[model samples]
Target: MSEQVIAAIDGSEFSEGVCDYAAWASLALNAPLCFVHVLDNHSAAPSEQDLSGNLHFGAREHLMEELSALDEQRAKVNREQGKLMLEAAQKRTKAKDISDSTTRQLNGTLVETLVALEKDIRLLVVGKRGETAHQASGHLGANLERVVREMHRPILMVPATFKRPEKVLIAFDGSKTARKGVEMLARSPLFAGSECHVLIVGAETAENHSQLDWALDNLREAGHQAEGAIRAGDVDEALQAYVQEHGIDLLVMGAYGHSRIRHLLVGSTTTAMLRGSHIPVLILR
Candidate 1:
């Protein structure tokens, strides 16, 4: 069966880049590409006011008028721009031999629409930061982490300048976090024929190295062809270099690599990877 790839396009440059990445993946996997643009009604709506106390001035009426005009303008642009984005993305992936293409303009909270569509989506490609996100926040889009936490499916976050992926890098640490990622690989026919490189970092002890090897052995047993290496360095740096050197298209790794609380306090290897790595990342928590 073919995979279903969903690209959440918000008419922002970052989101448009996400569509590009999604189209590339759809082409690579011979899957269908679904472009979704959610019109956020909640954000566009006006907040409730106390009519009992505010009967003196026409502030509420004025605010309502302004909000109505804004909503009208936003809705109009969303439909036209959304259709154009989907059409352009379709044209970009002409080589995919796509079975079909789908475009949706959903009206509701962005997360709600995406969650509702999650069951049928195999891969969800999103922008690292949306139009509203600031550069100095030291993170991705505000809703990005939330979606990753809530969505049952894997999310591939594409940076604004991301090029087409050439290879995939897998970061394994033999933990349940990593186990979830392995499970994704096990069930995913999308990656069956793709090239995968596995990296196991911080195997100081002989026993530790043995466990890493066992994980690689399990992957090989699962019918995936992977080349692996044990590296001695900071896990994030090693993975970053591997990605850069191999021209990796995607970096797959476990979220909260180790010591969740410590990670929360001082950030984790995955956080570092997000901050440093230029390629798209597939994070499994």
Candidate 2:
């Protein structure tokens, strides 16, 4: 299969924004769009009922039949709902002049499905908060961390509102992952017209300055008007402040600088930045 930009839709309020960003990315990268909706079978399964009150053999048989019928009905309804969500997403993509678009309703976890389709995906677009995450107060999407940790491709987490990015901020820490992010931005047309700003959060050291200067030169050589800055403070706080003060439309950063276990235990800077930023975040692995 050819590479495509995949959008994860869950029929939530943020689905439209996800579709918008996915369409923008598809057009920018000159790639086809694929919208996927997963019918989490585990979450959708009907609960078992207590039948101790009337446990006759015929009653038990009848109850089992009823429960089976209910399960079937629920599965049918879920399939229909997922189909509707995919159709709506497809229509939105087409409205954005993205005619080469397709939709799929998978019957498993989002991460598993994406992993299976990893080879065919150039980018993955998802909402900052999913349907369940929005219902839970002050909680990031449960799948956000896992998906970023598991997927090897770049993932774009779209916010509730869609904004055309004019200025893009890249959070650089001079790691190999961060360097790869810079190189990806330099080569990809996704941010072609956006002003690029490379922000390094640390004290002014010769090595730091050299890295920033090198990154700036790389972006400039790629036909982008780019600049670099050094900030001294907590990584997340300084990055968020810079984004807000400079009116950054999109935030780009490396994913999983530390091990997955460490990130799960103490939280990674990437996750913290995503939780703090109001703008869309592009996480590169």
lDDT of all predictions, in order shown?
Answer: 0.69, 0.83
Which candidate ranks first by lDDT, i.e. highest?
A: 2
Query: RMSD per prediction, one decimal?
Result: 4.4, 2.5
Q: Name the top TM-score candidate.
A: 2
- Each prediction's TM-score versus the true structure: 0.76, 0.91
Error of 2 at 200 (Å): 1.1
Show the colliding residue pairs in model 1. 165-249
For residues 1-285, what per-residue lDDT tens digits would candidate 2 score against the true structure? 889999999967779889999999999999989999988866756667687575876887788898888888888888899899988888877788987689888888878888888999999999987877777535567677778778888889888788999899988888776787898888888999778999988889999999999899989999999987999987777878899888999988775467332252136533466765688988777
| Runs with alpha carbons beyond 4 Å of true place in candidate 1 | 1-3, 28-30, 44-63, 134-138, 161-164, 183-189, 192-195, 218-225, 231-238, 245-247, 256-270
* Model 1: per-residue Cα lDDT over 172-244, one tens digit each: 7767667667667655655665567777776577865776667666667777666767787877778778887
Instruction: Please count the clashing residue pairs in each candidate, in the order shown.
Output: 1, 0
